[model samples]
Target: MKLIIKSLIMILFAAGAYAADEPDMKAGEDIAMKGTPEGATACFACHGTRTEENKTGSFPRMVNQSQYYILQQLKDYSSGARNNAVMGPIAKALTDKEKADVAAYYAKILFPTPKVKKAASAVLKRGEELAVVGDLKIQVQACNNCHGPGGMGMAPAIPAIAGQHANYLEAQLKAWKDGQRKNSADLMGPIAKRLSDKDISALALYFEQVQINAGKAVAK
Candidate 1:
């Protein structure tokens, strides 16, 4: 009986170690499509597939986002730093390796650029100013300083927000401003606090309509 118990423990440890190895994109793809037997919901239910857009506009586009960014977000959600009723449960359901694998899988997929209706010119202009040239009066820096030109994203961490869903962007900004989301408090928190509701709306709309070459190298 002692020998059997020891052997079982060894097998479990080995399995855990294997799972922590390099990310497996194939496993991630399967999890994204089918969810896990451990009670997590399928990612496709909210995020949609590469060919299909999530018309709800509540969920942000996931394709080609930085793997590191995605992984960190998942970690934040699991830890309750980024409070989301939906994402929290899902992130907790996934193992550390599963999160890494899923992030890697999404980062590799080539998604089509989204097309959204443009907001009023004035709104877009205000948003463009904020994104390209930070307001001196408010002492805010241009969003592009970190997000990269056209929101193409800075390599391993920052995510590409260009052509993302406006509704999702707006909601996230509001969440940060309201102190509901604290995962990126040092950077986004202050910036978002300075943005009025109108500013948030305009910025969201502006980014939704801006398109860029997905394959282009983002500024480091």
Candidate 2:
């Protein structure tokens, strides 16, 4: 009984700490629009200001990403755990609060209906097979198992990959394959290693073309 009481107190304290660390969405929006005082760049120039655009998923749609996933990626870039020629320097320039704020700002934005472009039938079929069900012969797990259905992301951690840039997705997968990106070792690493170049391209293309349900974004 006494032990249980102590555990409850510890849990409450941890929860309180998390709440205090939550970023201010308004402050984040300011940073996204304008450069930070510490020489950080404006995110909009690369990421774009709107939810959806006329172009293909090139720079990526940031609005529906999970705040925690975005923050973790920024921290990874800052610490050189994840290396990007552009993002590495940009992330390094940001203060921790600035990172949190920017992530929060993006998370609060609305998810727009994507203007998806069709991919080849063969590629789409292969992608669907790999995503919805695992390629068991290579020991790969279904992406949806972690990313949720249609790669809409399992919130509070995973970022939505649906309707993301095919090039960007392929690059990241290659990074994991080559040991450049080292964020999700236990999960993403093995899976990435198992993927062939063709598999990678197919998966990226599939996600690039699938639209997410705006508010719910649940697995189908």
Candidate 3:
């Protein structure tokens, strides 16, 4: 009898897991179609359904982004760990299931073609050098170790930092360095704590100027 009960429980758990994995594209489409004022933008307007215009230097293409990473980011934004006025309200309004559905929809989409041709400036170049190779005296690890050589980041965990707004990057780093941002991993927390104001600014500027080669890179 105990064995039969255990089997039933296992079956139920499997079913639940299967349900969780199912992608609800229709729901995602509906959300995209119905742009929320509080959310303040339709994802399709920026990301597009299927096109190369989505691949710009200013906007990190959301197409093909990892679902787990997207979900985590949404949660972070909603909770204020990752703060963006534009994204914060939008994230706050989404249910967990909505977040998951949106993430899935974007993750399944193919990457758009990139068109950005400009390179980083001298100051930005300096910032990039610092990010890729930190000063040992400062006890800073190269951002590349986790964010990848080009700032693409690891899937389902770390997020892509490439092409993010310099202001936004600066703010986030400052938050991390201080105790204001609390939702980061233990490793990141310590790293953030160690960063000086100057270090944070340099890293943010560096990532902002970096262009991601979508075909070769994965954003966090």
Candidate 4:
């Protein structure tokens, strides 16, 4: 409540249009925690509250993300470039400034630690192999090739996939393979299509246990 009030106050006192300056982070935080009644939705409802002790969830973690990445995704959703039923409307409703604001807010948050137990040794090994050096037999590239060291993302596009939910990762991989998700890197579709069930589970579970904030390194 207090945070919301402060955000409102900041907006009230602020002067001039936002064509050239940094976004209002306080306002963004409010929107993430409390969506505008008619415009957008609270991000925390699906994206997790970002609390220190919160468990990993099916929704992608948003904190510690690149600001440019978040804004681009929102813009893509709004423009129909990303085809998510739930996010499309919400992104469409948000004003450009709102999108920028919230993106800035989330970007400043700390990346969460691993919540799930580590995968079995065999699963872990295969996952690492696939992530670090992909499978030549399947024509798959390593996960780290684009996601940067530790899956920190390349910024302005791509995203940090380390420590994301296993279910979410697996579902997205399957979605790409099945053509259920059209918003993606062109390279992802063919790669996903070639993945076996073993690859999907191995990659998902492997990355889920990776801690981007805990000294995890992106494979060289």
Clashes of 2: 0
Candidate lDDT (C-alpha), each? 0.80, 0.76, 0.64, 0.75
Better of 3 and 4 by TM-score: 4
> Which consecutive 10 residues in model 4 have the weakest lDDT in total?
11-20
**In each prediction, how many residue pairs overlap at the backbone (N, C-alpha, C within less than 3 A)?**
0, 0, 2, 1
- Candidate 2: lDDT of 112? 58
TM-score of every candidate relative to the true structure = 0.86, 0.84, 0.66, 0.83
User: Which residues of candidate 1, in runs, are more than 4 Å off?
Assistant: 1-20, 214-220
Say which prediction, candidate 1 or candidate 4, comes out ahead on lDDT: 1
- Per-residue lDDT tens digits for candidate 2, residues 60-140, read 678568777788788888998877787888898888998999988888776556555678899989988898997989877
TM-score of 1: 0.86
Which scores higher on lDDT, 2 or 3?
2
The number of residue pairs in model 1 that clash at the backbone is 0
Write the candidate numbers in order of decreasing lDDT. Answer: 1, 2, 4, 3
Which is better, 1 or 2, measured by TM-score?
1
TM-score ranking from best to worst?
1, 2, 4, 3
TM-score-best of 2 and 3: 2
At residue 47, candidate 4 shows an lDDT of 82
